[model samples]
Target: MAPCPGRVGPGGAELLPGTALAILAGALLLAWPAFLNGYPLVFIDTVSYLAQTIVPEMPWDKAPAYGPFLHAFHWRMTLWGSLAAQVALLSWMLWLTQRGARGGVTPAAHLLLCAAMVALTSLPWFAATLMPDVLSGVAALAVFLLGCARPRLSRIEAVAVLLVGVFAVAAHLSHLIIAAAVVALVVVLERRVGSALRAAAAPALAILVLLGANLAGHGRAVLSPNGAIFLLARLQADGPAAATLRERCPDAGWYLCAFADRLPMDSDEFLWDPASPVSRDADGHPRFMGSVALVPEAQAIIAATLADRPFAVLRAMAGNALAQLALPQVGDTLPDTHLALSARRMVRDGFPPRELAAFDAGLQMRGLLPEVAAPFLRPHLPVLIAAVPLALLGLARGGREQRALVLAALVAIGANAAATGALSKPHHRYEARIIWLLPLAAMLALAPRRGRDPGLA
Candidate 1:
């Protein structure tokens, strides 16, 4: 084939025009609101972005510090001009992926891969919204592109890898698991501890710096005891069974009781039963109950629970993971006039009061697509459900060469699920951005050549 346009220097790979086309397509989707009121998409993205910006800086007195880099990015992105920065970062990622994937057995295949990435990642909602999720996606793509460019590390390529590591770390601390997975995979494939260490060094340092800053500024590390105590307090007061507990343990710290109640249950199950177990205190009037409050005591309880009910914990974790992967609603932030009208009509027709109320509320909140799209999209649920497994299969077939990339993606997704699953209302969107890996992995699977295959060029 004739040399693709925008080919780099002799040894460097050339960029494909397809990449530009994909980016343009995404840009067009993002710009839809200029003509049509893509309010839902815009609204969802805005809320998520706003949450990232406002929630983190709520003063140490309000909420515990979590995902510091995500919060920082939100703060900085807005201050430095929001939408423009988002577009620039996305464009840079597209360019990087295209350039990095050049010369990797098939240029056209790589270009097509880029197109697939655009298609999968073109969630118009996220494109318009200024959230760390977009940055996280870019960081992930950078890592993947760099890994694909392996076996030859130019000075620039080496720098890119390190920068990606740092960016990934700073983009989301949840990225730590993914980063570690990638590094481990690289080490296993290349058998070069030095390269693996180098790739991970930047992110590792970035994490430490973030932790140091948190400690210096807020006097607490991420997930520090004080933070946990705060979360426990929230869980107790605003949580299920708060009323019952308040009546019993008027003077007792509900945080400990809430922790005890939730310790045995995953988030999903906890949502079902918001009330805690009640017991009598020394005064005997059915006081709110909890285990000992000492750190060692809590640790002992956790250890005992794990030891006695390992299977249950594993089952809860598995179920929570599945729930996190499934998209609950298509466009959560937008209003669907269609659903709202339907809900209103149903109410007029004397539908069950509670059911109609739920429908009305859902219509008002999520709009029609997510509310009504289910029936139409039900058949596709199988495909969505199979994503994680297919990805694992791709990893197995990808051999040692690509194992690192696969493992890194897996670790990131897994960690996110684990962490979020422990909290209340584990929504799919929390980890939705990572869904880009599904299509990316599928592209890798369908690629014409296996880099490690002995028969390949």
Candidate 2:
């Protein structure tokens, strides 16, 4: 049968010519923050990621994937290109997901959602910033939709979602965990959607990016060469490792024995401070954080800590994860005008002079971005809080598609908290990065089915 006029046909297979325009408009809407900043918003780590293009090795804490992605999209010119691409990808995912949830919609409706998201959620902030955090949510949604709602999506949309998920997994290790959780939840809750089991392959294969990067950088095929060091830092921050360190000091002859008295240091300080026991040498110089010798010892210490204080480990993990869930407020994303001399030098030497000038002149760099963004934070929290009941209502509708999306959002958000807060440290940006999906899920569940299109909600 011929499709009815104005209604999307066959799982949104047709991308009308105007759809591209709508997507671009949506992209620009979400990217308005970057435009206002006169440059992409810079996290303190932006410099580190950008430097990967010119630097010899990946930073211990960052994956090599996002840097290359940024470098390729930016074409070695300005960071704006990378921001544009991130915005475009986010726009496309939101559009397609909205279509699947609604069964179909006019381009105007999708754009309205984009505008609302920009006005009301932290989505725009993450989308506008030069960070892999944006892609974590993208990958979570992709996995669930492709796994549980593939029947509701066109072939083109399926391929695109898979590609997006691949990029996401390649870009960050935490995304790999998020994807795993989404697939696990979908497969468990909706086994009829058997593809959810198969969807795990994308993230499974994406691990090669880390393996390759590790191989090239340290001649190792490990997924994370410094993962143990990170785990140790988290354990120390959470209190378990301190006990182990105290018990095993001097007798163990570990490098960290010298700092046994300072067992429970903050995770960020343990990892980044030049004078930190984790990062310092006997002479007080900063050591390469990914030092090969540290990994095995860190692993040993973490294992001993877990053995000595299993309950403490569990308590810390739960506490940190719960703490992370409550910390979705947006901050620390503004450009740091107070970058260290080394980082400043890295920024200057990393980009062309023109790009450097634009970076320095951004509203964020000038410290004005926060004041402009402050008002939005007020509205953002309420919107997210409202999304809780809205998402529950969405589940009540019992449409597999909407239900899968809601479940994916919860799992992704929870998994992200565990990965970042339990294994690392709780931070606002971690949850803020992916919370936009709650509203998107609610919108989909409430969308009324029309014409021959299946009823969505």
> What is candidate 2's lDDT per residue for 137-218, written digit by digit as tens?
8888788767765656666667778777887987888888998988888678656534755477568767876788889976
Error of 2 at 419 (Å): 0.9
Query: In candidate 1, how many Å is residue 147 off?
Result: 5.2
CA displacement after TM-score superposition, residue 326 of candidate 2 (Å) = 0.7
The prediction achieving the highest TM-score against the true structure is 2
Return the TM-score for each candidate structure.
0.58, 0.92
Please list the C-alpha lDDT of all candidates, in the order they appear: 0.44, 0.78
Residues 165-259, candidate 1: write the lDDT tens digits.
57555654555555555555555555555556665675576577556656765665652332332223223333322333434343544333544
Estimate candidate 2's alpha-carbon lDDT, on a 0 to 1 scale: 0.78
